[model samples]
Target: MSRKPSNIVYAAADKVPLGTLISLGVQHASLALLFVVYPLVAATEAGLSFEDTQILITSCVIFMGLATILECWPRFGSGLLLVQIPNTSHLPLAVQSLAAGGPALYAVMSLIAALSQLSLTFFTGALRKLFPPEVCGVAVTMLGVALAEPALRRMFGLADQGGAAMDLRYPMVSFAALVVIVVLAIFSRGPLRLFAVAIGTGVGWGLAHYVGLTHGPTGRALADLPLIDLPQLGWPGLAFSWAMLPAAILTGVISAVDMISTVVSMQRMDDADWHRADMNQAARAIRPNTVADMGAAVTGGFASASSSAAIGVAFATGTTAWRVGVVSGVIVVLAAFSPRLIAALSVIPDPVVGAILVYSSAFLVVAGMELILSRRLSDRRIFTVGLAVMAGLAVAILPELVDATPDWAHPILGSPLSVSTGVAIALNLLFRIGIRQEASVPVTTDDNPFEATTTFLEHQGDIWGARRDVISSAIPVVAEAAEMLLDTGVAEDGVVLRARFDENDLDVTLLYRGAPIEIPTLRPSPEDLLGDAAAVARFVGYMLSKRADRLLLGRLGERQTLTLRFEH
Candidate 1:
């Protein structure tokens, strides 16, 4: 008899359970509302008429949909099935860029951003090593850190002036919405929890409407809109500013990183790894975003990308497939087609969006924090890494402190996600290699650092050395072992230790004393099995828990290798 198809295969075939897809649809609708609301507000500030704003907003949603689709389905079998939405990263810079060079300049910059993103995608493998989870966690942390001010500003009711006169600033609306979302997410079981953001926004909207706070758009504003028109798309006429390059590059790089990170994180969430995933199929996932985003930027629309929020929808409902994503995209497309509907949704107060944003941003930060802390690092190493992260956050928030510095320095320094990560990596390397202790002394028991050395030595004489076996079984443990050996002088002699993981198992090299070693041992251990479930529940939950450390911690952290040579 044929075996029943597994859920994994079903998910890959785009067979998400219907209830889950609908729930995600609501989220896409709310996100689409923001696409209109925020962009219109920004465009109004840029001196565009209501009609122009409508044209731009409509065009942008379409652009976003295109990007979303491309990211999900690749024409050439290589897409990253990640959701891309209008990048919040560009909001601050877009305002500045618009203020300095008009919408035209911003559009020109969009082209540059797209070009850069495409280039990065083409060379993603090379860039992959540069952005490990630690680095990505830092970048994501900084993104939210930079966004805090804008969120606060929206929380304070700065964005609304004349259109859709709802005072989103009302504490009742904001706080009520926030409470609803929080309570639902924390307590509500199953699909209800997934709709927390959407429910909160809707509740806030209804409350605002009941309070007689908002008036429907009338007269001049109503007449100003074009019922149906093709979105304008072309190369922007704005002059290229050299100073703008860095900003564009920053935006582009962050966008690409965000897409890749979200994809990887989602896969982990779905218990899907790179090997199991159809790389060609996965790469095709982001094709929609590329086309839509590029078109949106050229047509005076703000760029958007997909959300990893799909992972939440999938995890909550126990489904993982492009169908959910496609459903979300379809909702966005439907909303985009109806300008009136778009306008009505766009009328949602900043506080509502602000409240949702605050929650989402906080969630993002928590995720980042969890990712950073999940890794096994020494206490001193953690502190060093933590300092870099905080420094980057501070730089992002109080940029004026570095006002004397060039604009180019801001992206590099203020971004805790990048700079601190770079620092943390450097520090990790230094701590592992620079620290020193007795070479011959081995830590035989788990009681002290020397115990690790003793343990390694105890197994060294066996046909299958512990280091070799353990290293082959788990790559991360190699770092732990090498640090121990290098510190104790065992690895200093530059010997290649060999060990068999099991009887008749092929011998494998687990570590190289002096160089970055690549030991290809692919097998799942108990920790690996547990790690998948834990990372999905909360990227850092079980990984960082003190209890998990005993089993998770490798033998290498405390062990040492003694290299002795005498004339033959």
Candidate 2:
């Protein structure tokens, strides 16, 4: 059986009609607007004037556009559809830094952090060896868990009031918005699905207004807003202090991990053939964007990273075309110039924003879990991830724990993500000291499976005295078959490829503990290639048959085995 391409229209390339492009662009713009809350929250916590907050929003939007443009560019980006925004993951740190020494300190720290990220691009290959999926996954999941409390506070409208009694209407509005978003996400189709967040927020805002709960800028304030204004340009003040170094380093590390995770997820969503993160592509994509983050901070905005909301919008609308991103970037830049528009958007109720945050944070937690489980769940991995997450939770939820930490270590210890990530990285490395030397290298989502398989096969061929031509052809045959199985979602976690070489032949086997999958025949008609998902599977079968001397698929109770042989 063969499989057909997805029915979702304009899911890739520039195939979308102009009208549809504009519509999706508008939808993306709306999703981008949702991120404005981060800057607003930062401003409120810092007690900045409305004018300064507006300026921050404008600069953030502009830089977000710039980062999006860079991300869409093939040379600098992963070449997948992605949108960048001020990272909410950095909000807690930003608030603390801002309160400690105002926006100047925040800007300086952000700039340093961005520079560190840029420096990291040069050593991504090394970092990849150190930070596997399990470690990174724990860190990301901890971040989401840590952020949930803040989201809840905003949802209950307790953020600004400082524990001064809860507003009953706030939870009502927030829960209503969350329900609407959930319903739309699960039931709506086409463009309506893409605008789920916007629609939900609008509903919540309308309800709050009806209940006379709207507290931010309103009709009079909006009316007084200028129709057009440019963000003021200035250089951020810089300070060289060792006390802030740990915080900056932690920020850089988290940003890099988040960006990599987002890019890998985007790739998996866009291409069915995706198996692992292309570390080279990820580094290329993140380097320039880190530069853009530096530009944003220097220009009076917070640091930015890839946006999960925009990714959700693309998935919901099936609008993964790069052109859509370009259009959205243009729209963002246009919106940045309109103070009235900014003012109108600024009035979005805190609860509405909190609902979106909660929604995205939930996904982040799920994604982190998936990443951790995508490989073999060894005892070491379990302990590493579990302890890191539990430690992070204790630090994040207990103010007394953070309060007891030294003032110099406050920035790093106060952040649960930082604490967990640092712990996970340290534990992962410590555990790897003597136990890492094994005959067979593990294949996980953190590893480039194709490259690793090829290298493994070549080494085996040399020991077995297999012909160069046989080894060369066998590599792709094995790689493609494994990729096909992964693409069809046949593998529960992932496939492990191992090669056994003897005096007369080389044998390769792919082991997976997943659901039963039918193996297609070696040959298929032209129609099979274009028919459906099953047809795609058949095409892979055909490719594998042609490349190997013998191909066999078998099952043993629970385990499935795919074998390929090459006679010397």
Candidate 3:
């Protein structure tokens, strides 16, 4: 029943060892902690004092932990190893809200985002078709692509403020860290593989420490912080503004898209026979993540989004046990109470974090490509994927384009993952205008049976946007039956091959005024085949049965029908 890839050491449902669970949890929690900088930057923009800023950061961590735990439950969450972290996509908006009306307006935006996302749950089924595998694949790929600049910047020793020259030592440390991660993830096995991310990060941290690369304000006063204390609460009263609603809604939608892409990628990684996305599951996945946004609303925390990078780390480590996610969530909550611990994680050498992101990004990008190519690509689909990719890259590639967009457009046009996926979904819906889901061809005795059948199916397959392997597999079933109907001389005029398609099934039904083609359950032996024409025909039926997923022989009023079904 488990069709997960061979490389999967522990799947989402598998019970894990306590030690491995804790180890992996610590790894993911460490990665999640690095993202605190997003909120830290937002706080700086808000002009809050040091104490209030620390309070905001703690609130983000508290909810991040709670959301992670909630995410492990199928009723409330994605039931995958999708970690919730501060939404970098919303950072611009967060800054705007903070500047416009202080933390109160920011909290309102977070609440708006929560409601916007909550509304999407009802339409999960509809959203699936609108955002096909290619569109979702583009989103998934960009999730990794977006990580490149920050990863590289940190890897090259970019400063906290800006415009810092790349340090040679930074790359040296990053290179060492990346090698450790890659070697352990790709070449090692057992516990070594399971703990690859943590091990590599530890190695990187140690080297950075030795080389005096762990340079940050937090490290300077690490000894002064308490080992454990209650995280201070700085409640920013919520107040909604009409001006902020559109932007907040946009952030919610973008965050939802991010969740969908990450969940789809996780579904792909978990199953070997991933045909299409399970959107019901995807919707459920989004539920817990959106709820995390609601967590931000009450706690005065920054808005959270699904972390594809965190999942990348899981995939790289060859395990995605839910237990690890649960315990890691707990660890994050505990870490929030320890300022020294936060301080320790805060100063965890930028290059090392960069190295981890770089390693994980490579996995996500390639995995996304596999998802995009999972189905057959028509010219229409090719354009859809290609154009969407360019649009997303445009955000990262051209800063002026983003800067020129109006304030309302920031949530959509500002982020590569957001703009790219939005374009793909829109274009996908537009291109679906002329494509017919059904097609038929009338076979005449004068026409070559193979040529007519193939041309019709192939053409329709492209227009219908069918899966490549699926349509190819279906071609022969229709061809063989068409040839049989014509050669047997049982048709009144000729025969009509009709093909119908939906997301789950590709059905081809042949209509002819003749006896139904006999579907033999048993394979014909050589003696049986040589005996008579009937046996040879029966053998042909048997052969076709093997090719098609399902075969049906029946009559519809005046016509005897033979239908072949291919599971899409």
Candidate 4:
């Protein structure tokens, strides 16, 4: 039998929802390792001491792990169920910042970014109201447009010595791979479609290998590594550099905006109600993330980028609880302890990962676009929303325009896309022509609908509010009685007692005990004893507690006072 639900439950405990969490953990670990390995490779080729390379590697791994932990297990008041990873989106900019001023630039940027994420939390409520469906849709769609360049690079090849790919032929390879993936995704059923990214990447990898174009180094040195230990936490030496402060702050702001968008998107996707309990759950989840984000920024790992993957995992897995988060944290810890296992999996190559990212992000873009399109916008409003979205994309993809801006202005303009969103939304509101008015409709009641409802509430003797349906049938009677009592002037001194039901038994008396009262009646009535106002109140209280739908009320003997019996 189906029981009436008080609240909507999005997920139930049934499936292995932990699969996506585990997959995301593994994927993040793989990405972070590349951050470490890529730098090490660069240093080695540049004739830097192996000791320096090892230190860099250790620093990156430790900080990345710590950041992951912080994001998953926050310590603050609100726990956002999200994780912080190195922002692959800022790879080019980060590298540039690093080369310009070394570790100082990186540390400074991260610190600013951490502060930005925290600050963004305050505006979350306002943001929800402003973006709604339309603005978010366009902004998210434009985000994908901005990301196209890097994705293309991954599919083809990194720049050659002359600043081009080893060959331009791989664009065709990448496009072909994308086509196959899209076709399978569109036609395949269930799990096959969901895992299309992985399958497509595998196929793409095979083609690359067969064509003798996948000429990357082969090594098995990082096998059989251990999988558990204490986390290393420390500050970066260049953290205090004033010169890098601006960059750090800029990065922080961008990260915070991205994090906000991610969480909001997840909330919508999972259809989270954002109730008190859900908010509390989110707060609990965000504690570790705070630490992780700050740690990664300070320690020169990846630029901190937060995402609501834990919540997404819960929704996807059909489990709306934190147990899965704990499981994900454990998996990450195990991977941190086991380096060789990660190295073995790293054989998938950068292009494959890039392909997967492109596919997923494309879906996000489309989702965002659909949201914006769903809004009722006039032609002028559409142009405004569209221009704002495009402007955001321009700012996000091209940061050089911001370089010339003043120090304080960086925060205002650093995250070109987010800043654009804010500006465009504000401007759109300012340019609005007029406010639309809504007409009110009146409802008529033949009998006072709230008449019995008032008596029911009076009998229960509770204060404040009650549900509409509980009073639905009784309201008319109670309202009529109230009007009659007012007209006759009997209500000035005496009180009316209302019983919920007319069942013959001692159950009604047992539920509400009160002093018996005798009264002269003007006309014939049913029942012998007249229950007092207190008795009526008790019956109503019982009904309210049990969430009863209907209530019964009538006069005792000839007495004007009524008894109430609530039906559950």
Top-scoring candidate (lDDT): 3
**340 Cα displacement, candidate 4 (Å):** 4.0
Please report, in order, the local distance difference test score of every candidate based on alpha carbons: 0.53, 0.71, 0.82, 0.46
Quote the lDDT for 507 in model 1: 28
Ranking by lDDT: 3, 2, 1, 4
- Comparing 1 and 4 by lDDT, which wins? 1
lDDT string, candidate 3, 261-366, tens digits:
8888888888877788888877777777667767666777877776877877888788877777888889988999998888778778888988988876787788
lDDT winner between candidates 2 and 3: 3
- Largest TM-score belongs to which candidate? 3
Ranking by TM-score: 3, 2, 1, 4
lDDT of 2 by residue, 418-467 (tens): 68877888887776665522124445555566897788776655433344
Scored by Cα lDDT, where does model 1 land?
0.53
Candidate 1 lDDT, tens digit per residue, 78-158?
333355566655655566667678767888777787677666656545444454455556655655555555565566565
Go through the candidates in order and give the clash count of each: 48, 11, 0, 58
lDDT of 4 by residue, 419-473 (tens): 6666666755655444221111111223342544454443332211112233343
List the candidates' TM-scores in order: 0.66, 0.72, 0.94, 0.59
- TM-score computed on alpha carbons, candidate 2: 0.72
